[model samples]
Target chain A: MSQTDVRMDGSAETRADREATPGSAGGRRERLVTHRERADSYYGRPVLNEPTWKDHDIAAYLFLGGLAGASSTLAAAAELTGRPGLARASKVGALGALGGSLYCLIHDLGRPERFLNMLRVFKVTSPMSVGTWILTGYGPQAGAAAATDMTGLFPGLGRAATVGAGLAGTALATYTAALISDTAVPVWHEAYREMPFLFAGSAAASAGGLGMLAAPLAEAAPARRAALLGTAVECVAASRMERRLGPVGEPLRRSRLLRLGEALSLAGALAGVTVARRSRVAAMAAGAALLAGSACTRFGIFHAGMESANDPKYTVQPQRRRLAKKRAERELA
Target chain B: MKRNVGKVVEYLPFLGIVAVICTTSWLAGRSSLAGRPSLVRTPVRR
Candidate 1:
């Protein structure tokens, strides 16, 4: 007896031959077509390390930091213009958000003590270190402003703090883009030019949302303007980012959930800006939508980067293509 | 003049706080770098 009698079909067909067949065991032809031109990997695994940060904690931190930064700026504007209500609302909002952002950052660090290790060095190459210093400068100022507004003490001190916080807030809002884009992640790195603007717009919208929710309609007019301006900026930056990213932007395009969030955010912002003047409910709804949209934007960007990082083709093909193009250009020259 | 003086007095603590923060950050940076020697590169000789 020969040992070749183990076939269930009572034939001598090999596994590869069976798999390559058109209508064999599991419809193999379609699988072959699906992966026809895809780049190879180590057993189809990612070449780079996936981010170890938790999705909710880090994404929420990004959202809260933006909110705090924008609100601080709004507070400064309101204070300078003598809109006490808006100033108070924005200051309180900024302080609360900064507190939450700090909590989220520490929570994400897993060990709270390790958060101090980040403060041990100030390296220009590390965005996180610079961000920590910015936060250190901004946090106390924001807290003092809010405290003075609450306590009705040291008006001059509060004014100075607001001025300081406003300056730091701008850096805070824009530096987050640096934080994520400085990484080797293809999607984030590629969108470095646009991410800051996108983030700033979202932050402004978030601040506007806070203002409208906290301030009276008359006092919240600035909030409405900020929301509209922020949303417009966000939409423009997002469009440019998608267009310029080439194939690296595929993850962002293919992400239906992120797309849905952005659509909702934009529609909500447009509606809020257009109709909030007449209806307080509309204003409040717009605020809620803007906040949700900002959250979605952050999560979407984070997820897109993760998706790009998970695929080896995204990591390798872009570099290879760029190198080849450069070589060709050099030869022509 | 009195109000100006009072305002200046009030700001003393804030200024002091900022100074302390800067000093602390400077010290932290200094201490970290103190242990690590600078890696200056020398020109390659033929």
Candidate 2:
């Protein structure tokens, strides 16, 4: 693999200069650091500056994750209403999305089972690790819920199984934000508070999409409410992200794709909110917007993260701040 | 409806098997690539 071209803020001192590297913060040269060595060399050079996934690949991830989460949420809702068919459809759909998402996440890792390595040592500091645990919990819970249909022959224990499954399904609904927040990317990290709401909106949008494709109008009726709630949630998520992201959020609001997606989403969400109670067609339009908006969010967030990683300022500045604080402490002592 | 539900459950294991196969093939590909040696160049000579 090739080494990343990461440099510090001082272009004059950094580019093709020994003392410009952050590792040489003291203006003293150290041994040359390899890319692999730099991976764990905190406060040093970065090795991986970008994700390998294409735009479509990233959209697929957002789609599958949202679909899974939404379906799971809908499943819990259906169960509460005593609608077995809706509940069944939700479970089946959620499993499909979950299975697809699991594949994409592993595929995107470029090291596949390296995911297992993540599981070996779960760290609170690692968002990915926490996400892994969430998925692990959700998977079996969903499976058990699906299993309950068959186990209903054992009526005595079936109630317990159903209750347990409902709890798991709820967790499956919205932990994705936790994954995004766990990243070192400023745009996503700063928007952590808004991630759950953003993800919630996207999840509702996904359910709306699937309903458009599969469920009959009467069956999909609740999707209208979901769409409205999701639209409102997405609006809040976007506003919250903007309020919190400051400079980093500029990419989301300013980038052509992001802006277009957001506009369409707003239009779609507004239509869903205003006319969904009136017409099925409007709900469909809103759902489409949700899907588009959700996809845009993933694309925007991923690119922004990559941009944040690429610019020397994002990586170096944070480390420099830490180093400066330490030096000040030592000098004072 | 009951019969159809049974039939769906019956096919689930098959779906799980397919998912397992896909995940395995993907992981195998990943391991082979990560293990392979890709070339890297040295820094400019001072």
Candidate 3:
């Protein structure tokens, strides 16, 4: 990682000046400081690295994983409640989404084969490691459940597998929060407290949307309920994250895509609740809108973090303040 | 009535999944801005 000298205004100072000159800061000191030591480092480029993962591969993967996990749970619920139509649709949906998620995950790796290597170790502190294990269990269980549902064979084994998938699905739906927040990304890491609930709600909304699109309106009542519940939880958690974030929350507020996503999701949920029973067209529209909204939310969050990572001010100032606060507290103690 | 419902069920989720994913990827790709380097001298307001 070569450090290019950048001016306070984001302009490149020179193509080959490795040394900081006195006149560079408009006559400030010319002392050589590591990127960390230059209290004025914010006057330059990014102090932290941007995410290397492709947006489609990783961000889309997050959304799909959530959808699949929730759908698996919905399948289990539908089975237990005697809604064969919903059960069949949700089982198939879960299996398909899980397949999509794996495709994105493997493709996102620099070396596709490294995906297999990810399974070589398990760490309690590592969300990625945990997620790898969860997906391993979830894939087979969801595949079996959907296969049995489709083929009309082995009812007993299908039921057992569906139950197991539900348990694994819960972990799958929520662990992405831990995965991202465990990073140093300001918005994601700072949102550690609310991300799980936000993800859980997003998952529900996605599953509900799929349910609305795939099952009969009468039999899809539970999916509608889940949609409403999930949207409410997601909205509340997101609002709280913004409020708690204060200045750091600027990234969340700045992404237009995020705002559009939230609006579309809420609108879809309202439509689902108010008019889904009255018209199939309305149900389908609401389903599409909600699914689109969930996608927007994930992409919005991804972009906002990249924006934060690109700005040195976002990285340097927060840490500096935190360190100062700790120093003051230590002196007092 | 059940047949109509099945027709919608059979097709839309597959289509919706594909549509949602493509839309997401497009938006993600479009929103990316080149990273800028500059001195940001804002006072920490905590």
Q: What DockQ does each prediction reach against the true complex?
A: 0.01, 0.01, 0.02
Candidate 2 residue lDDT tens string, A1-333: 112223544444334354334444444556665655332244455533655555444445665667776766766676667555445555566666677777667766767778777788778776667778777877776666655643346543444444555565445556667776766665666678887787778677656544432333334556556766776777678777876666556656666666665676667666655675456566556656665676676666667666665554555554656699999999999
Off by over 4 Å in 3: A1-41, B1-17, B20-46
Shift in Å, residue A89, candidate 1? 1.1
- Top candidate, metric TM-score: 3
Q: Please report the TM-score between candidate 2 and the true structure.
A: 0.62
When sorted by DockQ, best at the front, the candidate numbers are 3, 2, 1
* Tens-digit per-residue lDDT, A1-333, candidate 3: 224443655445443444544355434546686656567356588877888976777887888999999988988998899876677777777887887888778877867679789889999899999999999989999989877876669999999988888778889999998999999888888899999998999889988888887766656888898888988998899889988987777888888988888898899899999998779789878987888888788878888888877877667767888999999999999
**How many clashes (backbone atoms < 3 Å, residues ≥3 apart in a chain or on different chains) does model 1 have?**
0
TM-score of 3: 0.79
Residue pairs whose backbone atoms clash in candidate 3: A8-B39, A10-B37, A42-B39, A42-B40, A43-B38, A43-B39, A44-B38, A44-B39, A45-B37
What tens digits encode model 1's per-residue C-alpha lDDT throughout B1-46?
9999986775354334323322332232223233334422358799
Candidate 2 regions exceeding 4 Å error are A1-48, A51-59, A110-112, A144-166, A273-285, A314-333, B1-46
Per-candidate TM equals: 0.76, 0.62, 0.79
Better of 2 and 3 by TM-score: 3
Candidate 1, A1-333: lDDT as tens digits: 233223355554444443434445443323444444455344478878998876666776888899889989998998898667777777877887787778778878888788788888999989999999999889999999888977779999999999889889999888999999999999999899999999999899888876766665666778878888898898789889988998889998887656766776687678766887778678767777877787788878888999999998788778888889999999999
